[model samples]
Target: MTPPDLSVYRLVFRLGDALIRSGASSATTTKALLAVCTRAGLKHPSVSVTLGQLMVSDQPDDGSPPRTRFHEIEPGALDIRWRTRAEEITEHYLLGDVGLEEALEEIEDQVNQKPSHQWWKLVVGYGVLGTGFGLILGGQPLTAIGGALTSMVISFIFRILGHLGAPGIFGYAAGGFVAVLAATALNTAFSLDQVAVCIVAAIAARLAGIASYGAVQDAITGWYISATGRMMEVATSTAGLVAGVAAGIGAVRLLWGPSVQLIETVEADTTHWTASILGAMFVAAGFTLASGGWAVRLLALTGLGGATELVYLFLLEVGTTPFLSITVSTAITGAACVLISRPINLSSNAIMMVSLMPLFPGMLIYQGLLGSLFGLEDSGATLLEALITAFCLSVGGVLGQYLFSEGLWLARRRQFHHTHPGESFSKVMPEEYNSRDIMLPVFSKPFNGSEARPAGRTPKGRPTADA
Candidate 1:
């Protein structure tokens, strides 16, 4: 009985930890680590991935004790840059371009890399994002300017709170509070008719659309635990936002009187297709710029955003319900993101995030929260409608992603099983593993270097094929 080499286990754990921190789902994490193990010559490695933890274990061919390692993942900011780099390292490792030690070093470097862009870009991006949504929500030029200013303030607050290690709820609540307070003051001072639109736009970036989409995608991939965790996140953030809006409204009401109106919902001006399309583009560009994305990807996503908004407007003009219209547009945008991600050199999540920004129901949620607070007769109905809309958006994105990506994943897993017989679903990392194929080798042989290489080593450099 010999001691098993722990380097392979460590590598799997490291990669999985990076992906999880980058918000990869449990299924994805499992599939990715398993693929790495399988390619590295491990016979049957086991992987378990949750939102905040990753575990990897593998049996040695020499019949030594099975080696296992676990890592606790601290989720970080949603940065497509880091996520893409991590995946590329995995791909390079699988291609035999780097040995186990080199792969580990690369992962470490990626983890410690500084952000590509400075902080002020994010503030500007948020301003543009708010202005775009303001126009989309039927606000005039003044409202757009007001919303942009408010968004810059919210963005600053968000960064400061994040740096200070404040709770997410506090950031969301603070943003909501500021948005409402600013809009109320502006409306009162200038008699603005679109104050509600401005407030909604200012807080649009804080919505839980990404989390909602992740929750549905995790559930679809059979990662129920991860799905539940994401759902809880969505609920908490949204509740915090609603509470903040309520507090803001209360403070404003106290300052003025009960008769002092704050938020005034206006009918969406769909006839301004030009403004709507441009608004969507601005939203997309703003998100990309703020996230430190590249210029080429920003332009591509901006185009995608405008195209999606066009589809939404066309659907509305043709008499589809607003909910249905957004759902369709979001699905189309998701599919487009998947298709174009490779060409644009952007992760699908990055493209999807920007492409679907125009469709988030921030306005609906704010309006519903305001109504509920004031005890409007239709408040319950508006809130229900908002919930349904969020659900529909999630479903649409999940379905779109599944159509292009996950369905093919199942096919490949089945193909691998048929070819190899009894490999246990080819050890796919779902919602997490950077997928290329289940059992396919990225190169003719594994990289040979230090003793840290994967198992099944013989005199030759080639790894023995899986049984």
Candidate 2:
């Protein structure tokens, strides 16, 4: 095999690592790299992802031969800042002002850029994020406080364990266990009525790592290996979380009289609208900080999160099943998010990562686990229902994306943008803009460059179809 273009190889590897590390899907990474290579005047490239590795192969348009390079996918936290910046770089490159070298350097810088916000600030953001969810769930001040504090502690512990080189799942389980144990104590000690809601809300933020939307998107796009791997990781992490929450409850029950009711309760709006709205805003804000997202993005997500919850509530009141409610509401959010991606200057995927935070299956899953552990009569049925709810949320989110992709509005947007040139312009990248398409997309920019021809694998003058 001939040696590949080191520059193209480096850029592709860097971009893929950053995207995957930030929770972008394998398909998204492939799309971005293909787009980048195309714009950079390199030949068509093929990209593949496994659990902790990625391979990129470049071929001559002539089909003479192909050369490939492999890179490892490191475990890292979701930093929306890098995600946004990476998207911006892709957009910038597509714009064509920056050369291949400069664009590659800038992307590298984004990958290496240190977090601008302090760890304490992140802690506060997560606390506020949990508090907002608690409020939305009708948690009183005590429950809100408990949820906020517990979330902060758990997030910190998750980080510490990551630093200690623990498998990512260990941190998730630890956080879940710790959060529930603390929330349970608060509920018992203070007699808070919304303990279940509060605990679920607090843990919701971390559950984003499960990458449900990405998995579905990849599967639909024919990346089954990537999808299966993602699903397995998500399932393992979710099980760990559920186990932790259940373990906490079991331990707590041993110490005290049934800490939380764990019995079925009717869904009702016990909290005022003002409280719920505030909760939504804080949850969005907190999500932004914890994920290293920007202020502008936070504002959009706040409104989106609130609207989604209101839709969810309305659906519930209208007698929709919880699963259906989550699905329909997420679909709506997904469509709106795609339309707003340009204006918000955030990837739809990034927005969805947290916009639907309120719609996470954490609460439902917790309830189901509680039922089984406590030996409720309907435990089996409840568990099945919870699984179905998760299936709905993931499928609905992707359905919304597919609907948008095939819609006239998105078509017009794509047409206008592709035809228009340089308006100080940046765009969230495709489905990777993409339904990432966590489902977040990197930005795409256009520039032109010619690479020197190599042995049998000469550069194809024009971009070809992606692999």
Candidate with the greatest lDDT versus the true structure: 1
Per-residue alpha-carbon lDDT of candidate 2 for residues 113-142, written as tens digits (9 for 90 to 100): 676345886788889988987787777788
lDDT tens digits, residue span 1-467, model 1: 12224667667777776666555655555656666776666755677766567767666665777667778866455566766777777776765678777887888777677875457888888888888988887788888888898889888888889899998888889988887888777766777766677788888767744556656767776677878877777677777877888888789788866665566554456899999888888888888777767667778878888998899899999999988887888887777766776676555655676688787777777777778777777767777887888777767765676566655556766775565454344233221122444222111111111113223322234453432
Give me the candidate number with maximum TM-score.
Answer: 1
**Candidate lDDT values, in order:** 0.69, 0.67
Candidate 1 vs. true structure, TM-score: 0.83
Residue ranges of candidate 1 with Cα displaced over 4 Å:
1-14, 21-23, 41-43, 61-68, 186-191, 256-260, 266-268, 406-467
| Model 1, global lDDT | 0.69
Model 1 deviation from native, Cα RMSD in Å: 6.0
Indicate the TM-score of model 2.
0.81
Model 1: lDDT of residue 400: 72
Off by over 4 Å in 2: 1-4, 60-65, 75-77, 116-118, 188-198, 208-210, 257-274, 317-323, 408-467
State every prediction's TM-score relative to the real structure: 0.83, 0.81
